[model samples]
Target: GSASGGPDEAVRQADRLAKDAGAPASGTAAAFVNAARELGMTRVSLATPYDEAQTETLAGYLRAAGFDVVRAVAGGPASPAEAAGWNAEAQAKLVREAAEPGPDGVLLACTALRTAAHIPQLEVAAGRPVLTANQVSVWEALRLAERRVREPALGTLFTVLPPVRG
Candidate 1:
């Protein structure tokens, strides 16, 4: 992160990962916001493993996309294996600690965080729409999933609210 934390480089990397994940591209915070708002969201928080500067730049991009930046959490361990195994109790505590109340959508980011399992509970605890890295991953590629894959365990988005009519 060049203190500058190249947004272009970051987006390029995200684009490659989206391809690898079999997801659509537009692969930046703006793309994310558009897709999310498609599902009725306006406010979001970030959860990622980066130094402060990189996290802030991401926060900036989201804001540019018209998303309200509720919070920007920086640095979680670097990979999915590491993130998935994170103590749920501890992670919950961290989320509670880092979270700041706002218009009602807490985003549990980090494509590696494997947070779907916790979304429902988090929403109950936080009292809002809870978005996670994996959820967004799927939403960003509903067209790819092909058949309808909505389920209660997936969070309010698929399990509950109607998808954005665009």
Candidate 2:
């Protein structure tokens, strides 16, 4: 037999079970600002572990939020079971190729997708500021701190934006 419950109960159960889904809360934008400024990028590419349709929806959402997603990559894994299956080599290659040259930032979607593990490497390879779902919220938050932050370990987070004095 399978689990049975009301809609609300199901939702509650889902929320509980999904607590470990790896999706960070909404607070990365501040961190992202710092990342962007440090990285010296104003535009960015879009990478995702969701399907094409969902990716489109995400792109629209980001656009609505005022982020420019120049390059687009979708579907890191086929299903929830495969979420972490975002083949690092393939994914990195895809993202590298998809990224548009000369941008302010880069975002890899789906926090549950395990791309954060590759953030540093990806940034080095892409040679740009790369922020995943969770990282962006943090980035935005950090920018709000009113401090000059340089997160070298995170690579992209430490990247500075274009020179203002220039």
Candidate 3:
């Protein structure tokens, strides 16, 4: 879910709220960017279940975080329930389609889309890292806790330890 204001401000507000609450938080977009950075990705392509404008907002967020948004595409179920209905094959196809040659990695955005089961296959097809919302959330949570465990089935993010943040 997106906040009311622009992407950058939304992120800042979220962080501030989390800090005020004395809790750690990693927004999905931030987690996606972190996952991309950990995988050594500078250029990224995004695929989402939102319309073009929403997709561009996410791309803007990534750009604000210092990534080059090489490409962004959106075309999936219109609602969360519809996205949740997508199967692994459909999700894989969406990622693959967004895996245009320019990006070092692809970001499958949308927490509603189930992608934990197909990331490996999607990465192979894209020949690069594939970061998804849910996957990166898990990754950032583990990194916040300062724990790293290898779970190869979840794809490369799980295999590499997150970089230490200063």
Question: After superposing candidate 1, which stretches have Cα over 4 Å from the reference?
Answer: 1-31, 75-81, 144-147, 160-166
Per-model TM against the reference: 0.68, 0.61, 0.88
Best by TM-score: 3
What TM-score would candidate 1 get against the native? 0.68
Off by over 4 Å in 2: 1-40, 138-150, 158-166
Model 3: CA > 4 A from native:
1-7, 162-166
Candidate 2 residue-wise lDDT, 3-74, digit = tens: 123223434554565476643222333233335545555576776776777666656654544557676677
Say which prediction, candidate 1 or candidate 2, comes out ahead on TM-score: 1
Residue 13 in candidate 3, Cα distance off native in Å = 2.5
* lDDT, model 2, position 47: 69
RMSD of 3: 2.5
lDDT of 2: 0.57
Q: Each candidate's lDDT (Cα)?
A: 0.61, 0.57, 0.81
> How many residue pairs clash in all the candidates, one count each?
2, 33, 0
